[model samples]
Target chain A: MNDARRHHDMGGLEAGAIDRGEHDKAPWEKRVDALMVLLGQRKILCVDELRRGIEELGADAYERYGYYERWMASMTNILLEKKIIEVGELGARMAEIESGRREALR
Target chain B: MSRHEHTGGPAHAHGHDGYDADPTHRHPPRPDLEDTPLAYHQVMQMAVVSLLVEKGVVSADDMRAQIERMDALTPARGARLVARAWVDGGFRERLLADSKAAAAELGIDLGPIPILVMENTPETHNLVVCTLCSCYPRFLLGLPPDWYKSRSYRSRAVREPRRVLAEFGTDLDPDSRIRVHDSTADMRYMILPMRPAGTEGMSEEALARLVTRDSLIGVAVPRAG
Candidate 1:
């Protein structure tokens, strides 16, 4: 199915016009917009990983299609705003989770 | 249904398929680790670094110090970003459309590497494997989980993603489409899996509980039900 149809079928997403002022908007609002696309099957993604994957596919030349570092920074900011993962919490959590799993297996 | 689907060619060999059968104890040679294979500028940088070190232009102490600092660094910021993306749709969309913009929004930046987003759809599942090396989204997901960085996972994910997923308990039919994503470029990718059930009205923290680092890298499916 086409992107538009797939989007609509999944759930109507209000991917409003690409507003530059999105920079000033709250992270949660931006998240809502992104989620709409995912639910709509717009293929939620990470631009850096996508480029890396493409590059791995032997498209080193094609990898330079866009400015990746800049996009990663921007996308990261959006995710941070939602507090989905705390800035400094990953390390502790990893330790706790791993330790628990190890204990469980033992 | 057999989860292993034959896409085109038969799957490539894994790193440890016959590791025990080596008559000689020679390790495999490392692949080229140059930042850019054909870039003249990098060639010049390597030449300069070599020349400088030969002439004591830049002290080995300085180099060692820099390496030490880098080694002590943790990738928590990137992990935070991945967890956040798992919960927020707008950010996820922005991440897919433009990763740099998304990263900037979070105040973390990757100077030169371009970021890319690949989603895992029901029809087209995405699995990430570092066939050549252990390249991963360290910043977003912290250190790579043991399973993800394992030789078995790297080899199995690419050659037999359906079987691998089933091993991880994500059963998919053989006919169900599969796309293996390799994190080998200057760009990085994170999986946007289908949200699990029992998460209605759950807070981001709760949602994060379900976002395993492996799932973010597309190795394992998010737990649902």
Candidate 2:
């Protein structure tokens, strides 16, 4: 056994009973899943790259974020790391959408 | 017959239609972001998608098509494969040898990822778990269930499988051995459960009805019609 196993690598450990409950995926989550596949198809980001990004998320974020949320975090980092999208560009886009949403609400 | 040839919808449609009585528990309510603000990652996703489309990295139509393709894939594809394997010995061999290739022969694109089909016999049962992250056979089975990605399932499935199976209401014979396959980075796994008895002489489509998603995951054996 590796002495320093990553937090996401939780194979054999004591845990609570399984939650058998299921939920229909939200539209946003589906979009996340689709974008992931699409990114792979475009050779922009590979599964391994996304996976490595996720593996590096420390124990705190790994447990806190939802599954697709973690994926979103990973892909966002990968895109930025590859210089596909810059930090300012991502921030500006997000702000534009947020203000647009707010305007629609008003 | 192509096993699942005639279908406007699945022969055995599952209920999560909000009408199903889940007396025990229900998924947490999703906040109406209209009244509130979207989560950070939700905003990030929107921004990313917009940027991608604007950059011409991928078109909006490509996203729609990919999402539709993913949703269209369910356990039915796996069910169809199991039915074909049951009726055709050669297919069974090919399926066991290389599931992605076998699926491709049936026009199912399992992407480029390699998937291994584990066959369940009289004396053996197989279970799959991705202890790291949920590396499911997403192309074949669609998105994995939430429980599969849960910390409890990931931690316990590799060590206490039979007990977990019991939680899923599956109790195999004590004599039969259980083999747990931890899905790694490269390969994914799906189980080929043994056919239920007295289902002889049935059409492939009819046989496919007996093969449920849980059966494909080796959680429960199918019931004969």
Candidate 3:
């Protein structure tokens, strides 16, 4: 189905209880949000393009991810689509960062 | 009835046996990443930002300035606007007519996105939601609350708006019509909730204190002092 009819089309659906809890903004989430806005201001990407990238996330990821997590994933996809970064390079850098984080935790 | 007819769209034709049922549908996992499932995506975001800086797509200062700008905004600006609108009838007319210009009159630059002010009246209550994604009036109200972005709120707001409003502790009269505005496009929305009674002589500053962030989102009403 097209975007207009996808699962994200939640305008009128039966849903469970609303969780009104507020969480402190995580540092990484803030950075990602700022980065996306910065990129948009520079005309490197537009809001519609970003929205499209977000909507393109497959059904499972869309359901499982948090708001900023979805933003991060969409930004990554947009950068890759625009050829600002290669897929292989992104994977390698992500692996390096992940390993570094694990080391610090240990 | 056909599956499409039952679900109201072709998207749900696959029913429960679709995407989630596929054994290989998982995103490639990174064991070294933070233990939470979301951690991998966060790391990938950092990687993307690093690559953008390295490639000279945007400068470090640009990122810093953007972050600072976002940090500087708060819902206090929106609260002040609502308070001013309550006290001055002419200003309230302007706010209802042209929200962006009215916001500018009070020194709030709403950026490029058009903001429409929805007035909550006795006969009709207003609620805002972005069912597609969490589109909000960020320029006026700062970042939206977490629950505003939750799937439950997004989905249920349009289907059962009265129930949702009641959950927010905003019990409307049974006869009051509920108008749910979905921010699907470029235009963002903010609610100018009806000013509470018993605050007739209250100063605008004092009235501003009564406007909560949830009230601006139309989930609740400004409290009486």
lDDT of 1 by residue, A12-106 (tens): 22221111110111122222223222322323345443433433333332223212222233333333444433445534444554455456646
B3-50 per-residue lDDT for model 3 (tens digits): 111112122212131123233434211122233233666778778888
Top lDDT hit: 2
Model 1 error, position B203 (Å): 1.7
* Reference-based lDDT, each prediction: 0.47, 0.83, 0.80
**Lowest lDDT 10-residue stretch of candidate 2 chain B:** B1-10
Candidate 2 stretches with Cα past 4 Å from truth are: A1-3, B1-36
- Model 2: how far is B12 from its true place, Å? 28
Q: Across residues A43-81, which tens digit of lDDT does each residue of candidate 3 receive?
A: 888888877887889777677776777788888877778
DockQ of 1: 0.02
TM-score of chain B of each: 0.59, 0.83, 0.81
Which lDDT value does model 2 have at B34? 38
Candidate 2 global CA lDDT score: 0.83
Compose the digit string of candidate 2's lDDT tens values, residues B1-225.
Answer: 111112112212233322233433365323224344567788899999999899999889998899899889898989999999999999999999988888889998877778889999999999999998888887788889888888998999999999999999999899999999998778988899898999999999999999988888877888897
